[model samples]
Target: MSEIISLAAANQHLQYIDPGTGNSSGISEMLAPSACLNAAEKKLAFLYLDNSVSSIAAFWNFFNSNHACALLSSSMKQEFKDSLETLYQPHFIYDIKRESVDGYTMEKINSSLEIFISRISSGYSVHDELKILLSTSGTTGSPKFVKLSEKNLVSNTKSILEYLPVQSSDVTPLNLPIHYSYGLSVFITNSVKGGKIICTTKDILQREFWSDFEKYQCTSLAGVPYVYETLFRTGFTKKKFISLKYMTQAGGKLNEKLVDVFSQFAEDHNVRFFIMYGQTEATARMSFLAPEYLQQKKMSIGKAIAGGRFEVDPVLHELLYFGENVFGGYAESWKDLNSYRQELPLHTGDMATVDAAGFYFITGRIKRIVKLFGNRINLDEIEKVLNEQFHDSSFICTGLEDQVLLVGVKNFQDDEKIISHFLHSKFSIHPSVIRIKQVEHIPLTDNQKVNYTKFMEQHGD
Candidate 1:
């Protein structure tokens, strides 16, 4: 490291704020790892935390080192979690205090994480190339994980910093959880630049969240397409703010209608709105629609990030990404991570087409999985669940370009209600976006397999 860079890094700080109870903490980036992370068992560990400061502090100390971390979400299904326990057996686990919701007691919420971790007996061995393990949005209840190395993280983070012009003076409230790649990317990109991250567990809906935002002088906010929906509904535009320098939208595509709204809003306020696109496999981001061409390009995933390249497959038209940030591969458990291959120009599994202006537009999913607000859910996985639960019922699941999933269930009692409840309880998907339709029968091809195209054509709303 440069002497100047080292001197400035020494002055950098990390602040975490709790909007609910109004508690806060400050931790240094250079703090030593906990005693739990000794040489003997420092190979792999699981990291789960909300946007809490203590957790973030612990994360920097433990996760941002030689000991690779398997980032797991609390919202993930138990089946997937169990599979991870069997697969890449996390040598040790580090999770913070789970945020208390309206119904759960404080004690219940806090103890929940510990109770769950205690259930795991032993973990499998992690691979050498596995510097970081990230779950692929719980798609299909399959133990699909994007295995990233230190090179992937560093390369991608540097690219993000290069474009965003991140600075040590900048402050961002850690509104997004660390488990999500998008959220963790913000933490890594900001931290590397010696910037401040104000960790918080407060919901964006709460007034206290904004209050803390103002108090901490938060310079930027990041969210998925769904968050923009609520942001407008909450009258976020009416609020006055002097500090917010930029806003980034990723996780999934934000439709043109909202894009127009955000584009104009950001311009009027003199704040940049970056429409970005990426996959967890690329270590976080591969492309971002530059703020200048946001209106002209309109809904394009834009061009590749610095040092990254993407090409469309001639036959499948699936997007394939090439970059140092592209992951080694996926890991279902410790054994899978045992030997990692360098995957360059990784086939992204998303169908797409390139614009004349060099922008990329994702058209459809060739992979049975669809990402909902950045979480990947396999249509087949949903079908498998329904089959296990209902013998007399037949089900086919499909998703729209915008990620709103559709389930066509035939011969099921209270089909909508039953399926909606099951999806919510099992997958943590809300019924609001899930459209349940009563179908006479699932469309099938000559081979007797469910014809997804025909099913969508016949019953898609």
Candidate 2:
């Protein structure tokens, strides 16, 4: 691979913190050192392998100026990778270091960015109209992607900035992964206002993380249900973030009890806690429970953003959204990447009900997929993983909206605690969201099919 530029030489658009030292220079508007793709402003698309601070810096280097890019998790399985390679045929793949990359042309842009190009042309067109490609519900294995345009990204970013005003003086930690849309939006919105970001991979459970959080006087933090639960268990009340002004939550429904607790905490500390609702297709967020309505509409996902509004389907109970942020649609293969106009007022697969005050509440998902800690866990995919791990034992997987997973296993010898822990560490499922139950047997109907309804009814705990 030819070396294009070293990180030390790249432009510095924003001053980032040292992950180990927690030190950062003030925000700088100077163009961050970035490489110009050979095909500047061309209707080209490339693969982005996961979140690396530097790679993202390189991405912003050209996101709007150069070419459209598709973001993917680096840890995707091979079979899925092969299928995707056949679909969009990303002109280049960005990663940290070089390895076997399906024999694509490799080039080193800098310490944080590596690019691999395809040798043979694939008969697919990444339409000039397409901008960003995001995975649907964080499913790396799924071939389908959400197609977003420049208008979608900028409009959503502006709406969020309007509600959660930021400043150049503010210092926010990069608390979420860059590959995740929620986390990525934080980076984009903060950048739009020229706010400083304390980028680190530190976990909340770590003492060093807290020390760094305080050292920089970080202004805000973001998390999912699992993160807040960890904070509660680890004594979030006693700990003090003197400079912290606000926090945000999404990805999954928060328990009603925790909502009351966090709302009170915000009041006592004079901080803001934003409860939000969104999907990948919405380009990140569609609605949020404003701090003012936290107590009155405790569970409502507040009214739509500035230029958007939503309606509930009386019969299907699906949330229908009319907004500029709605994505172009789904793309499963290269053939599906053509320029297709998106009609306003889209159907969100989430089943919901609206309150008298015009606020929306998500009651359940229209499908069986469960959103846990911002990750999508398919019951069938999870069951397949469990079956491979728990040999000589059988289990059942059932999923629903706004609830934890219920895993039922028969003839199990492992302790329940161990089972939940394994699911958390191995499958990335939060321990609090997974419950292992000892069942008599896998529930079945007279037709010899797995009776998911009867099984959940009997074993759900």
Candidate 3:
């Protein structure tokens, strides 16, 4: 006999508490039934899931019920919004405010519950051909919608959970935005294991993060490389995160020196620092470097997850993934799912190599490498070398036709000193340093990826 799975059975404690205000709501309370009404209802669901686990639960619940929903980030721009409205023609918009939601304008639809009940009573399967639409990082081109299905999510979540074990007692701080893949996985994984998820809408880079950690006794914290850089700059001492058990870094490769510093800091405070790797195309995580092997394999993205296997091409050196969790091919439009194929393994555009011990270390993106003077130069390598020289500063290395441009965001005097130090350092090749305008901050994508394409477009020749 087939097993029956209900939301209450799956998640025993279905109440998701907002850490910011201590407001608690049942899983059903946060959801609007009317949001899932048919095409003729003229009603749409606009979900703003910021620091609220209920928002995530509601989204999944509605999505699994065959309702159409759009993921909106707190930092979405007007251009992106205009494009989405024109394309989806969504009636309702889930406005996620970076700040407080006080005085925000949204239509108060009253028949949401009635619409939801009517749909559920009709015996509709929410998971049937579900569509999850997301915008790309807009690094290479305009951000486009990535449509995924219920199978895609369930497969990815199951595979990831097999690798990273999350117990029921584990409390994960919902730090990253749910609109992004990384943040969404945190919710999916934790919810599957019946663990407690603490919701905090405030940016973890801000001052309010430490207090929330203390209040919630959060066990795990996950972020991108830049987030860790911010914590280091904000003078976040080791004593501040006494309750933290494990911290994972992903979204982008972190500096090796910064990794060493974080490993030490976590050691002092009795926490495990995990170096993880993933992209939206493969769900959130593909592999994670264990805390114990971090020192020896400091730069490795570790081995593949339990059910997944990774191989590097002998000729091209590109990393390839083979697993069920791999997404069902890309879709240009929502109706194109019929033409999507599940054949062939996923080819990640990253160049990587496996060590003698079987640990996979990503060298860099295949396109990010520059051929200057007949010698191939990896921008990531130059960035790593520069990071080793300057501990606290942020640097982005981009390739020009004949030279590699190193952009440093630091104090004027310190920038010069760091540049001088890098020039003297022994790398296989040395590029000319062009000191551009010193800025207070580096621009990052919605997923916390360094906006390299944007940087080149705005600053490069």
- Please list the C-alpha lDDT of all candidates, in the order they appear: 0.73, 0.72, 0.61
Give the C-alpha miss distance for residue 395 in model 2, angstroms: 9.0
Is candidate 1 or 3 superior in lDDT? 1
The best-first sequence of candidates by lDDT reads 1, 2, 3
User: How does model 1 score by TM-score?
Assistant: 0.86
C-alpha TM-score for every candidate: 0.86, 0.81, 0.69
In candidate 1, what residue range of length 10 has the lowest lDDT sum?
107-116
Residue 5 deviation, candidate 2, in Å?
21
User: Model 3: which residue pairs collide?
Assistant: 33-116, 34-112, 64-126, 64-127, 65-126, 66-126
* lDDT at 29, model 1: 35
- Candidate with more favorable, higher TM-score: 2 or 3: 2
Query: Using TM-score as the measure, which candidate wins?
Result: 1
lDDT string for model 1 (1-461, tens) is: 22212333454464445555656544433344344234543377666555665566556555535567777665555565556655655655554434322222222112212212333334444555567778787433457778887778878888998788577778887777787788889887776673667777776898878888988788999998878888888888767678889999998878788898888889889999998889888889999988999878887889999999999999989999999998887776566767678767888878889988899988876888767766788778888888788878988998977557888888888636878888887777778879888888888899998899998887675
Model 1 C-alpha lDDT versus the unseen true structure: 0.73
Best by the lDDT measure: 1
Model 1 stretches with alpha carbons more than 4 Å out: 1-30, 33-36, 74-88, 96-124, 138-142, 413-416
**What would the TM-score be for candidate 3 when compared with the true structure?**
0.69
Off by over 4 Å in 2: 1-14, 21-35, 38-52, 75-88, 110-112, 380-397, 400-403, 406-455
